[model samples]
Target: MNTFLNPFHLMKRIMLIVTLLLIVSCDGYQSICGLVIDSETKTPIEKAIIKTINPKFKAYSDKNGYFEFHNVTGFIFSDNDLTVVISKVNYINDTLNIKNGDSKLVKLIKTE
Candidate 1:
């Protein structure tokens, strides 16, 4: 009878520990920012598509080629584990891997 009671108590303690971990881990969340520029001219390209493979996240570059990915939460984004595919109407597509929890600068070159 005592052995059976011990398992239930242990399970409850494990669940409580997991719950506390979830709440405290939220403090490590971060956002990302960057700019997209033309590789040749060093000019910024507006409305370029920026995409992440994990979580299937996507954003568009603004007129100044500035992009901000906000509140991107997940465990898969640890330690620079993101891949971005940048594209525009006339430019060639470019793919890059980025570090997590930090800003990045990317340039996409256009080909005639």
Candidate 2:
């Protein structure tokens, strides 16, 4: 049987195209990393919460104000934008939008 004229071959080709299309259509996840700091003092804020919504998750900033949500759970599927909220005691919460392997420096203001 001519491969191109075979029914099974046609079905396989169609299936391959459909699979590739689905994969291309999806907005995939990525690794997110950043730092949280005090707006006034320009110092790192330890133990600050970094997170997202819907498929919610929370990560804490280390003593150096560094935080990371690696590709595994930190996966965000949007228009290449991931919004994360950062909060800690005595500090006003802040939000950050990280994109495509981009890291950020988030500064939170202190409460009076």
Candidate 3:
């Protein structure tokens, strides 16, 4: 007994495989998580507004100055182009790049 495969089916299967590979390998989304701290005192700065400049995402630091971007977390893969802007009253504005899946500590200096 011999088995035969249809050429159209084979082409469709190849196209589907290629599409799936592209979808999985493509960089889709990104996220940022970090701690906002006072540069002088070395203490966590709570309630600071952390906003992404490009994608326009926003979050606020907790009591420990820890903030996590939930939207970014939703994505499984991302590149290295995420910037988070940290700002608070009486403190200097700061910007940080989220990279390497590492948590960053952003220090803000108080203005006189």
Candidate 4:
């Protein structure tokens, strides 16, 4: 009989299949974690609104100007373009490219 069809080969195939299944069953999600800061003063900007489209997701900066959003599907199965909009009261809206699974530094300019 061919060694390829032996029980060892069969067991190996089953293990391979199980491994693939486990990988596919994992959560297909991305995340964006960062801090929002002032363009000039370089200080943290609290209460900033962060929004991303194409499987839309939103988050707000905390008192330390830190923001994070998980389970992001930023243009995953679509176009390569991903946009992130950061805005706050009396501040110039800052538009940035989405960087999945990375920490970013978002700067906003104050409008007067």
Candidate 5:
């Protein structure tokens, strides 16, 4: 039997095409993720506030010092760089110039 004429084969091909389209469309959004750490100790810094300056998206670092902004569309189609600021109570604030779909390791200096 011809593959194109087979009903099951045709259905499978259609499904594959739809799946690929969905995957490609999802690339329009960006995810920003990072780990906040102490500059001197090199340890994870909990309760750190991470935010983007332009689009005003904010997230707090979890106990493991992991923070993420998911499906962020701001600046995704723009040429301007995304600025991220991380700050904690005793740690000095840190800023990073990041792009869409970028992950970074931010180190904050401790305040005396």
Candidate 6:
């Protein structure tokens, strides 16, 4: 039987291609989450701005110092490094190199 003429075989091939595409595309997006805290005081730093430099995604730390960015783009399986900047008033800015789907604890020092 010619494979092209077989409806079931064609369907299977199409599904396989679609499945591969989905798997490959899944690696391109990821979520980032972290907590911001005062380095000296060990206290949560609220209202801190957290952002990714390359993709320009931003989120603010809540009262609990938790921030998250969902479905951020440009992160693939091979190159998943992201640069994050965290800043708040009176606090020295912090820069971090983190991977996609990472939850990190960040500490910021207060400027004298």
Q: lDDT for every model? A: 0.79, 0.81, 0.79, 0.82, 0.83, 0.89
Please estimate how well model 3 matches the true structure, expressed as its whole-model Cα lDDT: 0.79
**Candidate 6: residue 65 Cα off by (Å):** 0.4
Q: Is candidate 1 or 2 superior in TM-score? A: 2
TM-score of 1: 0.72
TM for every model, in the order presented, reads 0.72, 0.75, 0.72, 0.67, 0.69, 0.74
Pairs clashing in candidate 5?
none
Candidate 5 lDDT, 37-95, residue by residue in tens: 88898999888999888678899999889999976665334655678899899888888
Candidate 4 per-residue C-alpha lDDT over 1-112 given as tens digits, one digit per residue, 9 for 90 to 100: 8988999999999999999888766655677788999999999998899998666788899999999888775333433445789999999998887656778898888898
Model 4 residue 10 CA deviation (Å) reads 19
Off by over 4 Å in 4: 1-27, 74-81
Q: Considering every candidate listed, which one attains the maximal lDDT?
A: 6
Total backbone collisions for each predicted model: 2, 0, 0, 0, 0, 0
Spell out the clash pairs found in candidate 1.
80-99, 80-100
Q: Write the per-residue lDDT of candidate 2 for residues 25-73, one digit (tens) a residue.
A: 7655677788888999999999999887534778999999999876534
Off by over 4 Å in 5: 1-28
C-alpha-based local distance difference test score of model 1: 0.79
Better of 5 and 6 by TM-score: 6
Q: Residue by residue across 1-112, what tens digits does model 3's lDDT show?
A: 2223677777888899999998787655555588888999999998999998776878999999999875553234545557788999999898887763568888899999
Clashing residue pairs in candidate 3 are none
lDDT per residue as tens, model 6, 58-96: 899999999999888873665667899999999999999
Name the regions of candidate 3 deviating beyond 4 angstroms.
1-27, 73-78
In candidate 2, residue 16 scores what lDDT? 100
What is the model-wide C-alpha lDDT for candidate 5?
0.83
Misplaced by over 4 Å in model 1 are 1-30
